[model samples]
Target: MEEFNLQFSTAEQCLKVIADEKWQEGFECRKCGRTNYCQGKTPYSRRCTTCKTDESATAHTIFHRCRIPITDAFEIAYLVCGSPKMSSYELSRRLETRQMTCWKFKKRIMECIEHGAGLHLFDIPQKSQV
Candidate 1:
């Protein structure tokens, strides 16, 4: 069995990384196409000044609507991107989560990779706000 080398251990750390990637290109409000933003109600979130719509660091990324905690999701994403062959059973043991959950999430990650959207969290193509 291969060793699991997870990159992020805490949700806060993962959120910071996501936030950096999310806003590195500057903020564009999903609604009204405005670039102005303000501090959001939550950390790493951006509130569009024009539309008053708030988006989180994980809003449109692969982490969007993630069922697992951010830390677990990050670990899964890191490991999967690192070695795409690892079975969900193996991931379940490593994460101490349900195997089915791991399988479902792993499938999602694999789909992104299969489509060439990205191999890592930062590389995953975020869905444009519609």
Candidate 2:
């Protein structure tokens, strides 16, 4: 958990990283195909000026619709990527959360990592950076 804390001490910090990675190239409205955007209603969200579409840092990424706190989810990703041998049981214990929850998130991370054969944390650096 030291690494997780070092990289992201809070959920807001994690969201900032995601937002920076998501819009690294620039913002393009998913709905209007426009590049103009503004601060969204929610923290770390981007709202398209042209179409009034609001997108979250978690949207269209691995963290989308995650049930746990973003901080926990980020830690899971960090641990799973850094130590592939870790089990969900260990993860749950570390997080002091439900085993099933850790298992589910771990499964999702594995699926994404497998989907992009060479993927790891911060790899490929295109749209999704987790």
Candidate 3:
């Protein structure tokens, strides 16, 4: 795969990238099926215009429930996707994250690719429910 030149310099930038990519084809409210929505206080959240329900950009994505900064997670995912041979230790060094965290992220990404199961790191599927 070609290397992606995404600028994930900040948490907000990463969140915006994820949200735009996830909703590129357009998004509908899970609760009311409304196409319109409003941005939440956080860059990674959105509120439905119809039902006023809040949703996270990473809700159904591999980044879901992640404790690290979105930019760090995005960097990890990008590194893994771009260089499958990269070691977790190397990734951890590059991202300045804990080795265990890097290992877990790498393992999860590898499992997704090897099994071709669920959603891959870059493939953020829209959730059916918030």
> Estimated TM-score per prediction?
0.85, 0.87, 0.75
lDDT of each residue in 1-130, candidate 2, tens digit only = 5665987988889999988988899988878899999999989999998889999988877788778999999888888988978999999999999998998888778777877733433332233222
Q: Which 10-residue span in candidate 3 carries the lowest summed lDDT?
A: 121-130
Clashing pairs in 1: none
Best by TM-score: 2
Instruction: Give per-residue CA lDDT, model 1, range 1-130, as digits (tens).
Output: 1333344656878888899877888988877899999989888899999889999888878888787898888778777887989999999999999998888888878878887778544445644211
Candidate 3 yields a Cα-based lDDT of 0.72
Predicted structure 3, TM vs. truth: 0.75
Error of 2 at 50 (Å): 1.0
On the 0 to 100 scale, the lDDT of residue 7 in model 3 is 61
RMSD of each: 4.3, 4.3, 4.9
lDDT for 74 (candidate 1): 75
lDDT per residue, candidate 3, 3-108, as tens digits? 3434667777777777876777887777898988888666668889888888888766677777777777777777787788999899889878888888877776
Off by over 4 Å in 2: 1-3, 117-130
